[model samples]
Target: MNRNDTLVPQVFADGFDPARVDRSRYFLSLLDEGRAAGLFSEALFSLRMNELMERLAEQIGLWTNGRSSSVMQETAEALLNNLLYLLDLALSAAPEPRAAAAMLARTPVFPLYEAGMLAARRHLDRCRVYELALKKFEAMVLLPPGPAHFLHGGLRLWLDERDLRFNACEELYVPSSVFGRSRRLRGVAEAEAALAELCERLRSNAAGPV
Candidate 1:
């Protein structure tokens, strides 16, 4: 197929029919190659495109699941986290002339995006802990408040806060006790480790050849 014909197929391949993905990916790939060759403009463009793709993926995941999946829910959660990371990288790499002003202008969207990401992350963490707890031990351990319990409680609070903050924006609210337990048990270190692993995987995927 010709370039124009390939556009639609590529969009479909990426799990969407949005007309922009092809052009976005094309320019993004060019940016990537240019950056690899030490061109700053291409690097900047790649960052911008990455930010856009992260947002698009997030919306698609939300619309597709409506916050219902137990297993696939992590997919949505990871999208937000990945977006946040990409945004951070993009902002950092942005030229000094425009970076501060541009990020300041986007402050309003940032908080909402962050809250959504944290909420999803908390929920997914809890779900994972819930499953692990159920499988590993029949009953709760009676030791002093440990990693598991702490993770669980933190998730519970985070989830509650997210609901309160974003209730207006969200279509539905789904609570999971499992997520809370998972948060408590996992601890910040473990959570960070997992997040790092996920980010690495996503970066690998994103950086792979088109």
Candidate 2:
């Protein structure tokens, strides 16, 4: 596919805020490096994209007097899925900057394109760990005061369901839960560590190649 010449090659190019430019460049650079290493996934991308979409939805929701807009939600989901496919394809190719032009020409860069890299690169077949961690997350939520704590990039209990308050952060989900007394992770470090261990576990199928 021919690269779009009109593309900005970067996300934040307002040219007014130096800090924004620098920060965006840093993230874009991380994406380039991370993509080269094959450490990116559609799930991670969706997580970040949804966060942005949620915020946008909130503002637009206010304009519409708190009315729920399923259309906007659906549109965001579709866009994220398409973007995920494009990033997966572009990163797979791993092309270099062949030539520079007088003007800055770049493709659209998303915020978590770098974060999607820094976070868990893939969703493994060993979902057992996520299953267990989710149980932990559930137990925490069931506690008195209704637990609210950090898990990875975001927080928990965004959506409530029958017997289980779920949607902890973006990348997590809890469909249902069971009553069980178990040792739950207490600290942020502990929770993050356990999540990392589970999400990073390599599946036998995904081990061979990118």
Candidate 3:
């Protein structure tokens, strides 16, 4: 089945046995083989797998009553176990082990700095997407949340910057004042700067002892 077609089953709402859903097992198998063959980057693959696991958790949560049956609990546990296993594998495959070790020998500050840089860059990208979406909040609200929350939140922050009291629940009725006026452009600029700084930090840190 296409990944996109993996719908949350109605049985989940009635609290069906999670063990009955075998597709996760199949996906895990595919991931394992992909990793073994080096057909995918471990970090990227782990991130994607984690996303899938999170979606699964969300579906299960929505479907099952808080008091899950034994099979449901077991399935949840299995999913958690699988996520952690993949995480461990991804961390073990980090590309800068030698550099990290050498940096550790030089200064405790280096590793922290390096990690900070990487995190900043990731946040910057996140913020940029957010800012863009914020600028087009009306257009954004029409799109589904799946991958768009990343952008949606950024736009919300922009509204916040403008002293605009926007609620996502209000949905798509953005006044021209909010979208057309130049008053809120500063938020976008600031977001851009923040993102740029994050990218610079990442580049600098990666070029460090690591």
Report lDDT (CA) for all predictions: 0.38, 0.33, 0.37
- Distance from true location, Cα of 156 in model 3, Å: 50
lDDT of 3 by residue, 8-86 (tens): 1212122222233233233344345434444334553555555655544643453354355334576666545433332
**Candidate 2 Cα deviation (angstroms), residue 95:** 12
Model 2's alpha-carbon lDDT is: 0.33
Pick out the ten consecutive residues of candidate 1 with the lowest summed lDDT. Answer: 7-16
TM-score top scorer: 1
Runs in model 1 lying further than 4 Å from the true structure:
1-127, 130-143, 148-152, 159-210
lDDT of 1 by residue, 1-210 (tens): 532232221111122222322222232332343334333233344444555665656555554654643335665554444444333333333344233223422333344356535554554565455435433332434212343343445534543443222221222211233223232222222344443443344345456787
lDDT tens string, model 2, 49-104? 45545544643454355665644666455444433432332332333322111111
lDDT, model 1, position 22: 27
Show how many residue pairs clash in every candidate, following the order shown.
14, 4, 3
Candidate with better lDDT, 2 vs 3: 3
* Model 3's TM-score against the true structure: 0.22
